[model samples]
Target: MTVTAEREPAQVATLDPAAIAREASPEALSGTSRTPALLIEHLSKRFVVGRKRKPVTAVHHVSIRIERGEIYGILGANGSGKSTLIRLVSTLLTLDEGRVAVFGHDIEREEMRVKRLINRVSVDAAFFKKLSPWENLVYAARLYGLEAGPAQREAVRILSRLGIKESRMSRPVEQMSRGMQQKVAIARALLTSPALLLLDEPTTGLDPRSKLDVQTFIEELRADHDATIVLTTHDLDEAERLCDRIALLNDGRVVAEGTAAELKTQVVRDHGGAATLENVFMTYTGRSLDEDVEEESDDAE
Candidate 1:
């Protein structure tokens, strides 16, 4: 299981549905606010590797503002702090020097509120391998205090949209393809109808058709559910296809950011590379996108 830090500065947000309903107002729960969905100010994190050795700085003074209802992409190799940034925002890891706000609510001061507003789907999602997708999602809904009947109906609706047949939903999750499992992970995360969705390498190991299905669902979520998504991915094409804007991270810092067109234009104007997102990433990071990060082990934390 993924072990988040036990003690942060504030009370951890209770994921129980009753607690969430009691804490959030109608407008806040609706996710239709003028404030940005996410705000990170001068964020930083460091991990001590060994005795008498220098601490590894995983994230360094990164500041970002994501407007409501936008799909923002964070592109990086394995350990360029992409996951670290997401962890911090999701309150998995404590910050060393920064402030994160979700929809104007401080993550530290209003953790419960923040939790009510956002949900995260990691690339390595965990589930009961022997259990069926429906069972797993029903358990999740119960944890979040949802009614079983309504939750099952919603789960079936969502799974069907993601291309999971009713027959397949009854089979063990381990029997399904990785892409199918990933779709189940996404469906489970949406049980609460969170306003801000954090997707970390969402389509990493899917087949072509499955990738398209998941991508289409992401787009639909934004259009129909009023979700503001922060997505991290290794696929440049996926980023270009799904994101409204992109930020390229290198060695724990943002090297460049803009729309796909703007980034391609910047690379051509400044670095004389081909007008493409690949070239933009390569020019800014001084390495090919296919190359793994120099600090790969940091992701295990």
Candidate 2:
């Protein structure tokens, strides 16, 4: 199980469901006099690694802001701090440096409130081998303080919408495909109607059809549920297809960021490479991990 830190810093907000729903109001998604759904400023995290026990920087001073109803993608190779960054936002890891705010509430100060407003779906969907999809989701919903009857009905609705047959939801989750299991995981996370959904490699390790199904569901969630998503992915095409904007991370820092077209144009015009996400990834991350950070010039078109 993914463990999140559980300590209050005093003066935390209420965990009331209505108060959390106000955070996801239509005006909030419209961005009219509203703060970002997620805001990170100079965020950093380090881990003590190696026999020498020296601290290795897992995430440097990375910063990002995501508006409500936007699918913001974080792209990086393995160990580039993509998952580390997600953990920091989801409260799995405490920040060694910097600040993170969800819907204008400080993560460290208002952790319970933040937890109520967001839910995470990791790449691997964990489930009891003997439990069916409906049973698993109902159990998870009970943990989130939902009545089992309502949660189970909603689970069937969501699973059906995600292309899982209602009949199959009765079968053991262990008997399902990885993609099917992922769909169930997503359904479980949506039980509380999280305003900010943190998707940590949600489509990883799925077969092509399952990958497409999950991708379509992700798109539908943004359109139908008004959920602000922070998605981390290794698939370039998936990012381009599903993300409104993307940040390319390298060596624990954002090396470049922009819309897919903007990034492609930037690489082609500036670096004279083929206009592809592959080129953009290579141009920004191919350098030494210890290289100086790439600076962004605000005047650029």
Highest-scoring model, lDDT:
1
TM-score, every prediction: 0.86, 0.85
Judge candidate 1 at residue 194 and give its lDDT: 73
* lDDT score, candidate 2: 0.79
Candidate RMSDs in order: 7.5, 9.4
Candidate 2 lDDT, 61-123, residue by residue in tens: 987877656788998866789989999999889999999998787899888878878889998
Candidate 2 global TM-score: 0.85
Q: Over the stretch 1-301, how does candidate 1's per-residue lDDT look in tens digits?
A: 0111111111122233354456544444453344566889999999988878879999998888786567889988777899999999998989999899886788998987788778889987679999998899989888867887888888888889999888888889999888889999998888877767899998876799998999999988766654678999988999999988888888899877778888888778876969989898888777786565334444444
Q: Which stretches of candidate 1 lie over 4 Å from their true place?
A: 1-33, 51-53, 293-301
Residue 260 lDDT in candidate 2: 84
Give me the displacement of residue 247 in model 2, in angstroms.
Answer: 0.3
